[model samples]
Target: MRNEIMRCFAVVFTVIMIVSGCSGREETKTAGGGGEEDTKPTYEFRLAETHAPDYPTTLADKHFAELVHERSDGRIKIDVFPSAALGEEAAAIEQVQLGAIDFVRTSAGPLAEFNKDYAVFSLPYLFDSDEHVWNFLLSEHGDQLLDSLESSKMLGLAYYSSGARSFYSSKPLAGLEDLQGQKIRIQQNAVNIDLMDALGASATPMAFGEVYSGLQTGVIDAAENNYPSYYSTGHYEVAPYFLLDGHQRIPEVLVISMTAWEKLSEEDQELIRTAAKDSIAFQREKWAEYEQLAEEEIRDAGVTVTEVADVSAWQKAVQPVLEKHGADYQDLLDAVEALRP
Candidate 1:
């Protein structure tokens, strides 16, 4: 009887040990299964833009974030800081180059400081229309100009809608002569300054983020920007006049630091490329809708929308500004002109 009891005890002990070993193996498999191990590497991407959250570029960034998350299966996440939350456009571009930040959506103005060739896009009347700008970006010359950033530690992903920048002021501007003595806020770009000067306005180079306060405080009598920006920034509240001169159709670039780009996996890079292309199309559509809506909203707000009699008059006034930069950017200027109908 004692031997039988010992045998039964031994059997129970062996069964418990077997069960415990199996459970341990199951736990190990569950923990280390597939590519989701607790120790697996995760990549965090940060993007900065100096536009309001409701702007089309911000919407594009949001779409990019979603697509990256989906494509990477949550292995990668993008954090988008809008409205200069990370820093102003110039500062954000600098941070991206140093690898302190992953991405930035910057206008051609600040980007020109890094690559002078980018200044071509900032030139007055560079692109005739939105379609012209879009075609140029996809063209060989556009690709070359954008790729020039490789030397600056930045890689261009895509171009976002900048819309045609036109003048908005408290006073009416029927012709180039009307701009005489007007204090117009221009971007911190030499071409813009020269253009404004040529057009007979007192050109004040200021940051886009500062334009509203500058206008409100009477620091500036007029400014130039897209319809959406004028309305969204509440500049309409002060300026109250919109001029459809369509002087420059500058496109915003979506760029990533080379450091960040090189760190992405091959498959991940492909996913990003595809997503960027899709986001570009998405952004363009949103831009059109926003621009139309902005026009109506600003008009309803008691702002006078003026259609200049002859845009050629304004163009002729700024021709000297073009001639000054033509030698260096002649090739790009010629190519853009060739695209005109």
Candidate 2:
């Protein structure tokens, strides 16, 4: 009787061990295979843009973010703040430098404040046409300038077209002479200020957000920007005249904070770089379409749209501005000239 009882105990103990072993194996398999949450993003980043959500650059910013997220297999995520949610270009640039902001899409004009190489874009009449601008931007010289941002604790990812910035005002800009003595709002750049001064206008360094009220309240008689900005900001309502002088084809730059960039692995860095480059084609296409749309709609809105068939006189007026700033960037200017058609 005692032997039978011991045998029964041994068999029960064996059954318990077998069941526990099978349960442990199943848990191990589940852990090894991972689940939905395991594939989620490990890092999150932010990109800043002063343009509205519907603007070309902002759209491209979102596209770039999406590309990074997808290519990283959801290991990385980027959130874009458009319409100056984070801050204006200057403040955004400062934040990126400090790594408070991970990325920014801002005009090359503001970037000149950090690296002088970017000031080349701020030179009035520097690019003869849109093609001329891209020709230089895709060249070795432009790549050098992009790479040069590393010293500023920023990385230049890509460039998007801001188109040519032209002056528009409540007064008629029928000719270059009309710009004389006008109070024009411009970005806070010495070169831009000098360009306005050379054109015989007073340059008021103001944030972009204030331009509409400035024009309406008579604080500023004029402001310069591309067509999309003119219409999108509703500045055309206040400043009814549009000039197509096509001066200063300042391309907007996509930049990343070095602090944020270094945190990425080599594969991720390449992924981001390629994603940025890929986003450019889409942005450029949208930019061209929007430019035409803005021009057409603004004219329909009863805005006096004037084309400067003779930009020579306007270009000639800015000669002094070129000479003053051009001396520092002779090589870049030469490169730009070489790329001209």
Candidate 3:
């Protein structure tokens, strides 16, 4: 009877030890799950836009945000602030460089101040037409330009269409000579100032917000922008003369801070890049539609829309600007010009 009890106890002890050992192994394997990483970490970022919600660029920013969130499966979230809410382009760009702001939609004008090579886009008549501009943008050279922002502590994701800037004034701009002796409002930038001065106009650099009032009060005689911008800002109410000289077709860039970008996983980084490029098609389509509507509405609102028959004269007028800046960024300009297709 003693032997029989000892045998039963031994069997129970062995079975219990085996069961416990198997359970411990199972727990260890389950915890590691074949070395898969945790997937619950969430990331959030902010992007700034200086345009109104209805503006094509702003709309594109919204679209970009949507695509990123959706493709990231909600792992990444982007908050977009429009209308200079975060600050103007310069301020926002500074914030981005400091990692205080994650992203911004800004013109190449201000960006050129950071990289002289960027001024290649600011050159008047750099592109023959909208189609030519797109070809260059979609090419590998454009990708290299976008990547060049690494030196600025920012990453250029993509370019949004701001369209070609033209002369709009309260007075007639029937010819290049008409620009003579006019106090034209321009973005507070060196290249634009030089460009206006070359055209025989007195370049009065002013805040974009002050432009409407300036035009209303004759603080400035003329200004320049694309159709949608001229219409959206109510500048047409005062400066109703729209001349399609199609000067600088400077593109608006979508950029993110290198600091913010580096924090992202490599996979997520690629995801954002893909999202930015994907938004380009939608943005271009929206910009074209908005441009047409803005043109039609501005015309209907009694704005005189003039088709400039001789852009050659205007182009020739700005040759000095080209020569000066071209000498500064010869390689960049030459590369851009080579993308004439």
Flag regions of model 2 displaced more than 4 Å.
1-41
Between prediction 1 and prediction 3, the one with superior TM-score is 3
* Residues 1-341 of candidate 1: C-alpha lDDT, one tens digit per residue: 99999999999999998555321211112245576654433576789988899899999999988988797677677888899998988889999999788889888778988888888877887777788887788888877876789999998888888798889887775666678999998767678778888888998978788898988888998999898899888999988878888888888898989888887667777888778877988898898899999999999999888887677877788789878987888888778887775
- TM-score ranking from best to worst? 2, 3, 1
- Candidate 1 clashing pairs, residues 3+ apart or interchain: none
lDDT of 2 by residue, 1-341 (tens): 99999999999999998554321211111123545233222577889999999999999999999998898766677889898998999999999999888899999998999998888898988888899999999898988888899999999999999898998998887778899999999988889999999999999998888899999999999999999999999999999998889888999999999988887768779999999999999999999999899988999999988888887888788899998989999999999989998
lDDT of each: 0.83, 0.88, 0.85
Best by lDDT: 2
Predicted candidate 3 versus true structure: per-residue lDDT over 292-318, tens digit per residue? 999889989998888898787787889
Return whichever of 1 and 2 wins on TM-score.
2
TM-score of 1: 0.86
Q: For each candidate, how many residue pairs have backbone atoms clashing (under 3 Å)? A: 0, 0, 0
Give candidate 2's error at residue 38 in angstroms.
12
In model 1, the runs with Cα more than 4 Å from the true position are 1-40
